[model samples]
Target: MSHQTGIKANEKLIKVFGKSKNGKLRVIKVSIENEELNCTATAEVKKDWERDYDKLIVPLIEESVPCYILYRLDSKTSLGYAWLLLSWVPDTATIRQKMVYASTKATLKNEFGSSHITEELHATNKEETTFDGYIRHKQDFAAPAPLTSREEELVELRKKEINTEINTDTRHQTLGGVTCPMSDATVAAIKDILNGTYDYLQFRIDLEEERIHVSKAAVVPLNELPRQVPTESARYHLYLFKHTYDGNYQESFVFIYSMPGYNCSVRERMLYSSCKAPFLDDLNALGVNVMKKLEIDSGAELTEDFLHDELHPKKFVNSRPAFAKPKGPPNRGPKRLTRPQEQSF
Candidate 1:
């Protein structure tokens, strides 16, 4: 769907946000809403600017499968798009888990720096971060007063402009509620730190340095004494996954998280009973031959596929019916593969 008329880039129909101060890309849930059949979609900052239709974006419109598209919109001149193959497209009642892992990229020298919140981990971008790193914060909060009367007037004018444009913002208006993975653990952690349960522990994180700055005023790192932090249930959900065969069960671990922001990636699932891995390695070993064994089909991810079969996969038999069970872009060039075949490499 090419929304290329008056839609401004500052006000994007699709948004990219979330992910803690860490590199974790906060998982987002999207479903087809008012315009279900409008697969011909496009967005732009200005009407006259060229609209480069990405081939991958076209195949993200499907009925059964909930599509996850990666949109990095800087402006009309600087932009990028891709289709994200979700690991599992759960029902409306989806769960978001808080897991942590460290990945070291072996790029030629060091080319790929962190780009968005979805990008969990990458080599440090010291140069860019030091100069152009932007600190994104919640906007509903109050801001410090401007130094001059002129500045105050400008702020008020800007605020008025924002108010006029607020209704068009579909990004913050979450169409669904998410039950994050660590609800139980998150509750306990917040209760302990945020509540008066503890003596007042101020915690902060430096996104650039990738360091946890925690301490009481005028104190030191937790070097008061040697101790081990809690690594119990924390590890269980870190890379929580299951490995199951037909009736029988096996072990598996997710070798990769989000792919290089591309189209039609297969995130497999298992069927067996439940178990916990206190270590990531133990869980990773379980999913050894997953792609090698189960991947059944591969083909060109064309616009037809994006809007039909390839973008969305079928749900499991026993799964409940989803609330809005349906749901990207323009690629005018010759048809191309919407997704890359994992086995072909």
Candidate 2:
């Protein structure tokens, strides 16, 4: 995600991009502070602005510090004044700094009016911060090397592959194929669970055939639910929780979705996630009223106690003593009065 500009940065940018500036604002250097972009320095256009580029911009950047430089180009377009966005992420900078600067570059340009930014120059070292280096960078982009016949074929093939993948996925999703269709066995297992023939039911996606199949179905006890979860893949579990809560015998249909953490591939995770809601809907349509839903990364977390806590959360009754009003002082009897005796001279 992109970071936003700080208040100071926004205020300074308004002046730099606005028409009220009386001074010749040539360059504005921006830095990241507390994950927000703020203006660190600004340079005014001097008589020899080209010669002073290094003196004005290079000093603000460091070997370990990443910064952004907004330099006003001499060329002006019909939209407004053309500006060059310089992204200075040095090689010695931390990984986090590099990521933040990269993500925030677009935001900085957008806030300052993207139309005004005619070109962008990325620099990683002191040498690239010079005017000559920027010219060379522009030249390299202006005229790229020509591709050979084989390379051209490979490029076309790559484009076709991407387009085909996207179109196929879109077609599948539109036709409700992204969430694999449930097989007959899977549907039968779901029915068995609803009829109480099975206490637990689990499903797995067969990616090759693009179908969901019943991987496991048995009378698993509440305590053994954790053992039934697959350790290396994602599965959907439907369990019948029959427990007595507060002397009342209760039976609830619980749905537990478990994934074996990052060990599962991204494709597996995405497929499971996309199929979850539709699978649950299928169960519900078949008369399985799931009372509770739980999502977990590991099966070990699916203990009986965890399910109990989730199904019947412990209610806290305010046990502190209530405030008591103080009693009024008891009525006192009238006191006798005495007069002082006069002294003789």
Candidate 3:
């Protein structure tokens, strides 16, 4: 026995266009070839194209005219093919109309009666509201309310919690040692604790029975750290000794402390040593020699040993022979005049 079978296929939906009361056109419907009311376009208007009664009005419609049919939804009457929607036309402003509007606005008030409109047109072409004005408008719409006493207390508590968390995180990250002093917020918090705003513990450093106690709450401010300002002692010293014997010493000390090496105390001691009067004098002497070699100054204190070691170390090693005076030829007496000279005259 033979049996008959049926087959089915999916179909594509055709788009239907409609016009609004404001004269703006929009897509109305889309459905399968045989299906009714299968899908409809939402209220969102397509930004790039406008749908007229039975046609899509696009910028490129002039290039190739496509056939389109319009249908009335209620009456189901065919409106016929349309190339361009009569409602969709170029919007043009007349000079008189522009002048009338420009005369009222403050921005264009001066340009309304001017001889040339180019200047005013250029100025108005790039007009835009500033960010500050937009932000002010936003704030004006939704202003916050004043906090109550309890709310203020709660805010203070939260602030303290946040500060504590930040401090803990910073300490954990800098477990070895701080590269620099504490920031303003951390310093202020420490100062508050030190001033008895909050209770804090003390740490003791014992050295040979002498105990030096420092409060954990008290922290040096960031401004007190070694900074790049000329007024800072370390920076000032570094500047003065930059071309001197202490140049390398100061650089090494800053690097050692910044990197937090094992011998930090030794580096600190060396820095203090360089700041002494005798060391500073030696550094100044070296600086003077450097300046002299550069032909900038002749008053540099050029000691014999300094000149030998620093200025001409290699030349001093291979001592060149001193220049000797050259011997002159023996002097000769004047010759006596002969009798032939009288004949020549």
Candidates in order have lDDT scores of: 0.24, 0.74, 0.26
- Please identify which of the two predictions, 2 or 3, would achieve the higher TM-score against the true structure: 2
Query: Pick by lDDT: which candidate is best?
Result: 2
Quote model 3's TM-score.
Answer: 0.13
Candidate 1: worst 10 consecutive residues by lDDT? 266-275
lDDT of 1: 0.24
Ranking by TM-score: 2, 1, 3
RMSD of each: 32.2, 26.1, 31.6
Give a tens-digit lDDT track for model 3, residues 30-91.
Answer: 22123222222323334432232213322212221111111112221133222211111111
Task: Estimate candidate 3's RMSD in Å.
Answer: 31.6
| TM-score list, all predictions | 0.16, 0.44, 0.13
Spell out the clash pairs found in candidate 3: none
Give per-residue CA lDDT, model 2, range 1-45, as digits (tens).
123323234565566556413337788888878655677788787
Candidate 2 root-mean-square deviation in Å: 26.1
TM-score of model 2 (CA atoms) = 0.44
